[model samples]
Target: MVSGSNGDGVRVPSASFSRLSATNVLFGWTWPQLAVGGVGLVLLVIGGAAGFNLPVMLVGVLVMAYGLVRFQGLSLLAWTYVWFTWRSRLREGSNVWSSSPLETGRTVGVLGVWSQVEDRAQVVEGESVDVVGTPWRDACYLYDPDKRQATAVLTLKVEEWSLSTNARKRDRAMALNNLTMTLASTPGVVELKETSLLMPTSAPVPPDLDDPDMPSWARGDLAELWAMPEIATPLANVSWVSVSVNVDRLSTRSRNMDRLTERNRVGVLLGDIVQNVVAPALVECGGQHGSIRWCSVDELRDMIRCVSDPAHASSQRKVRRGEPTLSYCEESADGEYVTLESCVARSWWVTQWPDRPVPAGWTRDILQGDRMIALTHIWRPLSMAESEKDLANKQSSMLQRSRLADQKRLSRDERRERREQAQREAEQDANWPDTDHQGYITLFAPDKSRLDDLERGLRMETGKYHLTLNGLTGQQRKALATVLPLGV
Candidate 1:
């Protein structure tokens, strides 16, 4: 259920499951547009034949043109209609869609699915569910008021992670962890796709050029000159590389500043715009010389900060009547305070790894200085110090869980060893040669009834017993033949 009550209020609700309308997808436009066009065609052909004026005739032509467009099934709009028509049939009275409802809850919710004609597997068809982060992702919606944290971590019951020993499980874990956290915290997520590993698709990368003239200045350093198109080129290749993040894992570090009022959001809107959004444009601008460089997220933000004038000098100011002076003022940092560098190092830390290995000094600061951003990006909003704390907490918890699980497994192994030892001892006792070589004995029942009675009597005396063959002596075989009576 989408949570109803919480103080910060609803920013968004977790998908529980998101339903997508077929009409919203490609070819969904078919019937709706066709219906309009069909009526319009009737009007046009009728009006033209009925002696309407040139303007009316032009309107008729436009209507018929729309009908042909519907017939062509070329454009996105027409494609939607074609899809709808393909799914819809005149078999019965009701129109039907091609795909069935996907199980979202106890009662399945209908979200249309499709791939393509040649697609035998029917892969990558349906609504796109983008799993992204918040504050960093700017993806929150005002829906679920109570945002649950820590308790609600995203977990995929994956097949055993059969990663090679050299693979970086930690980085992969961290990346997935934070990606999950962001998507979980921001409840507006539609779907989650992993690619490159990309989820939801393995389609070819789309072209990023919105305009041929739009210069790109991505990568390089975070200086005034780094991202300007006047100096660099290749701005056309810029597309925001989405970072993965885990929200609940990071929420322990999420700071709830009473400072997030309407006024705060307004101020944050401009500054955050520069830091989070606008800085990328610089790198995307590329240089005039056709050089392309990637900027670490920090470098982009820092360079923007370097060029930007400070909002105000940190000064002691009078507090309002009810408000505490400490709330608005910057004080001497105590031992509890943390530095930004430490925070970034930890926040960016993922459980996954680099197969070969990158150097230890791979902070965004250092990467930015080197004018390189990682192929992957992670977004978190806390000050570097807070992010670091969250990272530490996540690691500590994971380690503890690992230890506990290991301990439990160790106990099981010990129990199994004991069982084997007991079995071995029992086997030795049974197989040990009787010191007295006790007299051998054999007994047989003459009939099935007698045999059942013997078996029952043995069960009464013994808990569990192993069966063995009686010695096949020639006399024993002759007696068995005689026991058959008439058959013998």
Candidate 2:
């Protein structure tokens, strides 16, 4: 819950997210569970017809139990399937990737990632306004060939909470709420990803002290002093929001056009959404004009590189066109962490957020510091119809579950609290559309030896904020992809 006000002002905003309902496909059972249970039932029927064979009936009961039993939130059967899938991927060497320059016609620079970057400028927009005269010239879109989706990035300049007054913080919080609503209502927008990274600054090279006018002894002493390690300081804060447009959703009306034309049309629609829809919402958050703008091609590439390889983020090397944002030459996923050419990384999913209300910008503590950590939050917005249907189903399910609990004579206090929280959620949904959100945080290290220490520190840091991080032990590769800001 969050609220802010100053003397006679309206309450800013407050939200309750105490519980999340897991809606299943049929009668609170997933498809896999239903299928398995059906087979078990058939077996029991056969046993009954065969004079109630004790062994057969026992086997059937066990099978049903397997389908119903859950381990770490997954049914026993589903858990077994996942384990086998992970092993298969590992045995097939699919979890390992190594780039070979000698291979002919092989796609480089983050293979199996997004497709080429394409310009969204059109002839009708006027050639003069289409082209940009900056280093990362012209607005471009990252196209995913597999999904046929286009993603556009916007660089955000958020206001500092510490520097703002109480009234300003209240306004900013409301603006953030408005931003969330805008994203949910925007047409053709499938996902919104906000990525923030902090890169550490390295010690500066000693100045050229070999002056002919200076004495030799003094020059030597000065050089020695400059060679000492420099104090650590904050480097840079890179934040960007990527908005992905669903091409298939927008292409329905333009069936007669060719593929290229359809893609261009979708791009034009995305450009308008960014400019007219997202830009204004961002302006409110920043408390200033022009707080958000479309990221240029070069800037996007740099942002990707910074998240990909933090050690070299401050390098003076120019980001070339069509060059891959990730600089690693090899990547191997292990049981606990992933080994890359330049760094070792481990990913964690945020399983819990703060259960109680806290001040705004509470997350600043995690993002700040010299640690090499990146936090990516992905939001999949639901349309009005979808939101209404989902909420209705969830509310009904909650009430039914509550009734069952009452019949079982379960803990009354817990059930009552959950029902009240569900009610608050329903009321909130009535005011705004619903969005599915997930967060992933990845910590990078120079080598495997330092990974454990970093993980310990990260876990402790997150514990302070009541945030829980569950390490993705065997799914390191997938977790890495999920945490990175490549619209994964």
Which number leads on TM-score?
A: 2
Q: Among all windows of ten consecutive residues in candidate 1, which has the lowest summed lDDT?
A: 338-347
TM-score, cand. 2 vs. native: 0.80
Best by lDDT: 2
Query: Distance (Å) between predicted and true CA of 191, model 1?
Result: 4.7
Question: What is the C-alpha local distance difference test score of candidate 2?
Answer: 0.64
* Regions of model 1 farther than 4 Å from truth: 1-32, 48-58, 66-488
What lDDT is reached at residue 350 by model 1?
Answer: 21
Error of 2 at 33 (Å): 1.7
TM for every model, in the order presented, reads 0.18, 0.80
Candidate 2 positional error at 322, Å: 7.7
User: Could you give candidate 2's per-residue lDDT for residues 162-252 as a string of tens digits?
Assistant: 7876666667777766777777766678888877766554446555686688888889888777755333223666677888877776534
